[model samples]
Target: MKKLLTLSLSFVLASTLFIGTANFAHAAKAPAQPAVSAVAKTVKQSKSYSMILSALAQNDVIGQFDPTEITANEVGALINKVTQENPQVLYYKSANVWSNGKIEFAYSLPADVMKKNRVALDAKVKKVVASINKPGLSELDKVKAVHDYLVLNTEYDYANLQKNTIPADSYTAHGALLGGVAVCDGYTKAAQLLLNKLGIENHYVIGQIGDGLHSWNQVKLNDNYYFMDVTWNDPVPNRPGIIAYDYFLVTSNQLRKDHSWIEKNWAVATDKRYSYLQTGKTAAK
Candidate 1:
């Protein structure tokens, strides 16, 4: 985790590949995070990852930025990183073109589709944030509040996705937060946004399950960091109001049973203080 701290944005910039939790459906564990002084500074400086993310948060293509601070390639990386880190960044799907120092991102939803859905999406996020923003909520309490809301609200959207019909931008936060029906990508991205909003540090985890790509979130709660795969907890074909702590908070050793990601890509999950079952407050199912 110290290695992660050395990097700008607290290793916030990484390829966090997210796939539907179909293949690795029955998986779970979680951990906590270190302090946020370093990350807070990075966010304050308008660092590369957060900078490009802020640009796309407006729900538009990339326009301008300080060249010296962010490169075209990094812009592409930021698109994915931001999508995983901030759920509000449900606008563009992926980086379309990054040439001549001018980066243009592709939209997950077409202009017309975005126009119709943007208002509703914004309203939903606002409402959720308000509910999660109550005073006296501890960082962990806030994290749980956001996590429960996501698993309760979102279901793995297999039908539209398998049909290749884009009812909403399932590839981004809009799909997860607004539609309440997203696969792993949607669940992971939604948690990323909510956790960050609650002031908890987090980053995306991209890895492979079998032959397919998959993604989930690694959150930093106070001085201890852990992992949370909201997608894995919310069962597929989801029964409403059934939230599982199976994957609520576990260490990397616990997660290795079913998940794999490039170790060099992000911070290692070593903290076990917040692991759901380990804590004794939540019994293992």
Candidate 2:
């Protein structure tokens, strides 16, 4: 019997595949295997993660490799790591892992559509980064600029989320950057793309918010890690010209009040110096 494991991480476009292993939340709710633990776990298996990433980067739709007898959970972790690392590879969504080490990916959009969206997304990302990541801007400043830009521009896809009619692009950075609407996944991916362009160190986080699935980002500033959730900062109902910094550059303890994640595949964020609320920077602004 071939075991088929379907990994769904709170994405808007998630669908139920044949029952096999774990069932993760969609992007609306977003991630919680604690950020620090997620990073630690993935590090131990970095070799396998790198190999899978290399193949995906080559745009190979389906590939086979010896992952050295990984279980369903490990397969899920590996796929999540790759997705987190390469947010630009937004076309690929879910991974279909077989017992024999054969891996197939299900794309969120068709090839032709993805190609067009990729071009548009890349152009938009370049423009946005150039505008926000100005010369001599400190890392914190750059992160804030991108965070505010995203919140001010993109509106959460409440309509689709409520109607269960979410568009494929709404789950990717392309939607957040170009379409002006997205879910948490889209927001996180867009942040990842912008930060990568700015040369800021960051990682994508997959976890949960009180039993609900969600996705976010953790960024490195002056060697200290901090969590950022761009989606939560961007209010629903399409509020324009308002940016919420509640979750901006926050520590794990601060975020843990409402957000919970697995403690296996990410970095523990404890720095509070850059937290917008910690220094009362929001009050001054």
Candidate 3:
């Protein structure tokens, strides 16, 4: 009886051990990762301006600009100039004109109209442009130039903040340069226009950030991508002036920390440093 009992006990213990080992092996196999969708996947692995333009065009968000109206040689020259000086002032003509002898670009508005509306913004852009000397710059330099210009010239107006009143399309470079005050959309639009003239492919990204609607820019440089937020970079009203560099040249993950973009329109970035910002603090792992 004792020998039979010992044998039976040994068998039971062996079976339990085998079952435990099998369960461990099963657990060790990784859970199947969720598949990324075609739309959700990034178009370019890096943050180049061309790649950014391609992505924007693919998404159908960039507003229609008559390609024929833009001269190729002029565009090339502008790009070269921007890459060299990182100028705050950009050349603008109502219609395309190639000749270089004292070109006077005309606007129908009265001489004092800009002064009455937002004179400071105009002055600032002009001053910055005159100061910049770089041309044919990389996308990163373009972003930095705009970012610095905005920071130096603008201030956030909390009292004027309205959900729907912010004008996006009308904010010209002259306006932003002079007043140093504009809605998020205004800041972004002006940046887009200036960058476009420089032959840098940039997109005016409209999305939600925190509890408010916001507009920003995404630029491509050297086959890589980065985000720029001129509005957020500006100092808050009635505060010691400080520019927020957090949004400058940041990845999508870093932006997710304080801002949330639409899933369909969000541009994925190759830089992984900010990826943790996307998923809350859980990304710490």
Q: TM-scores across all candidates?
A: 0.72, 0.79, 0.48
Candidate 1, backbone clash total: 16
Q: Provide the lDDT at 232 for model 3.
A: 62
> What Cα-based lDDT does every candidate model obtain?
0.59, 0.70, 0.42
Per-model C-alpha RMSD: 8.4, 6.3, 24.4
Q: What is candidate 2's CA lDDT for residue 120?
A: 83
Each prediction's total of clashing residue pairs, residues at least 3 apart in sequence or on different chains, is 16, 37, 33
State the lDDT of candidate 1 residue by residue for 1-285, as single tens digits. Answer: 111111121212112223433432421111112222212233422665655666676656654445566554444444445544566655554444333444455554577767667677778777898998998888888878888888777776656645545343555566788777675666777777767666778876766554445667787876776778777776656677766676777788877776777665666678777654533222222
Off by over 4 Å in 2: 1-38, 41-48, 55-59, 67-76, 95-102, 275-285
Residue 71 local lDDT, model 2: 60
**Which candidate number maximizes lDDT?**
2
Can you rank all candidates by lDDT, best first? Answer: 2, 1, 3
Lowest summed lDDT across 10 adjacent residues in model 1 is found at: 1-10
- Local accuracy of candidate 3 as per-residue lDDT tens digits, 1-285: 111100010000000000111111000000012112212322232223232233222222121222333422233322222211222222211222232211122222434553344345445545555455376665566667777666666554343432323232123344465555555544675677567655676665545543444557776766666677766655444234444565666777766665556645545755654333223111100
Instruction: Name the runs in model 1 displaced over 4 angstroms.
Output: 1-51, 65-75, 94-99, 161-168, 276-285
Query: Is candidate 1 or 3 superior in TM-score?
Result: 1
